[model samples]
Target: MLALNWHRPLMLLAVAMAILTLAAIGGMTIDDRTLTGLPIWTKAVKFALSVVIYSVTWAWLIAQFTRWHRIAWWAGTVAAAGLGLELTVIVIQIVRGTTSHFNFTTPLNSALWETMGLSIIVVWLATLVASLVLLRNPTSDPARNAAIRYGAGLSLVGAALGLLMVLPTQSQRDTGSAVRGAHTVGLPDGGPGLPILGWSTSGGDLRIPHFIGMHAAQLLPFVVIALELSARRIAATRPVAVRTALVKTAAAVYTAVLIVLTWQALRGQSLMHPDRLTLSAAGLVAAAATGAVIIIVRRRPPVDPATIQPTRTAPGAIR
Candidate 1:
């Protein structure tokens, strides 16, 4: 049974949206008039599902960080309201037979767009604040600490990419199209794309990096947990320091990958159409990441087991 808390409302909202998404999928077939030439409400459904997972995961994770219940409550509240409003607007616009994002069709639409954008910013700022708080109050477990730091930092990068997405693309400015702002890079909006993701298969798409970076909050911690379990399985006497170093190394490599993806998109290259130069650059990034990891691991001195505390089992805490 799920506990009743600030996060619970958001989870319920997510459930509702999920049901609506299924309904949309079942009721609405392909609509050529929509943005992506798919169902008009597809993006809203995707955003709903993403937020559902994000809200629940964030709430659970934050609870494990600090025992300050007030801060956790407020963070969860802001996340719920902000994401809820954003999704509401998107769904409303879809029902009205229009695009939700980058829509300045009328004064009302522009106002709605601005409201949605501001709401997103508010959520991002709240998340940033909470992440900083977690950093300031470090966890006893070094492995978890590394995960929290890396997750928070990468999550910020992801939010910043949201800012990038909102800005008017150079192509949009050049063409002076009615929709003067779009998420796509090399290709125009609603162009050839992959199924479901709608990522431009023919050219660059900013959403790729945005998606990858945003989920780092969830991914980094999962990696830490896995590392911890693996270490225990090997019956390593002292694993905290080693795990911390490994997490840092992984974070560095993850950031490098995000950078490479961003660079690739900015160059108007499709993800699948990477040139020789792109491949070479990626290879260099990987090599550098590996070298850094090797150096860190070598430098990591063996920690005395006597100095370390037995790992505690907190709710949602990394084992």
Candidate 2:
């Protein structure tokens, strides 16, 4: 793990990110409506939060994949570039009136930011899955290989998408009056062109589908983390009793957090249509029911205890 130990900077970066994120949260202007997109603030916090996601995830990915530092570096770079490009899409749309400013209530611009953000999350998930697949050797062991591959692969994919970019505004502009975008700017006089650089966030709401997807990364990653933990505990167990207990414990926590995230999605809706408690309450109930179903379906199926070989064994033995 010498190759990995050489990444104190990455850990430091994560810590710094946490600090900045907290600071941003603390500094927000406290009108509940403001956060939910009711009013436009001088600096938009939600979009800023997306940047924090990229930064924090990028840092963690690098630290985890230190053994493959070079590859991790490349992926992180790409992911960051992707985030930047997404940001540019947001800014351009906001500044030039091609789309709505990251607000969910309206479907003005293409949901490119939310789309790429989720894509990055997917890349991270892919790394985790790929790592698990790679680490299945007797000598190196599946567990070990998985950890290394995920850490490195996530960081690398993150980097590539970072540098490569697509312009969303240019997209809507080409279509002209067909798009009424989040930016609130639209076709000329009656049809063919947008009011160049037009920007407005008046009455923005969170009821839209794109924002709901944005919150899933927050929920899904944690779910994956919980599942992986449950899996590891199962593999480490030599007996059914121990595996059963750990898996249950992990599932309980995972289910709870998943519900919490679903509720969060509703919070966006609340912002969009003020005083619509019926809609919001309905959402809460739905999110809870869905989370429950997911947890129930994810329970560990009965398996023979003998099937799982120990994670570590003699040199030639399966691990």
Q: Which of the numbered candidates is closest to the native, going by highest lDDT?
A: 1
- When summed lDDT is taken over every stretch of 10 residues in candidate 2, the lowest stretch is 188-197
Could you tell me every candidate's TM-score relative to the true structure? 0.86, 0.37
Which pairs clash inside model 1? none
Give per-residue CA lDDT, model 2, range 1-319, as digits (tens). Answer: 3432433433343344455445445544443332212332223345556556545644554555435556655555554554455545544443443333333334444465466456556545544443343343222233333333333333333333332222233445566534323322221111221122112222222222233333432443453355456665545343333333433433344434334433433343222233455466556656765675455445555687999887666797864
Candidate 1 lDDT, 143-166, residue by residue in tens? 788887888789789778877778
Please tell me which predicted candidate would have the highest TM-score against the true structure: 1
Each prediction's whole-model lDDT (CA): 0.77, 0.41
Give all candidate RMSDs, comma-separated: 8.2, 12.6
Candidate 2 global CA lDDT score: 0.41
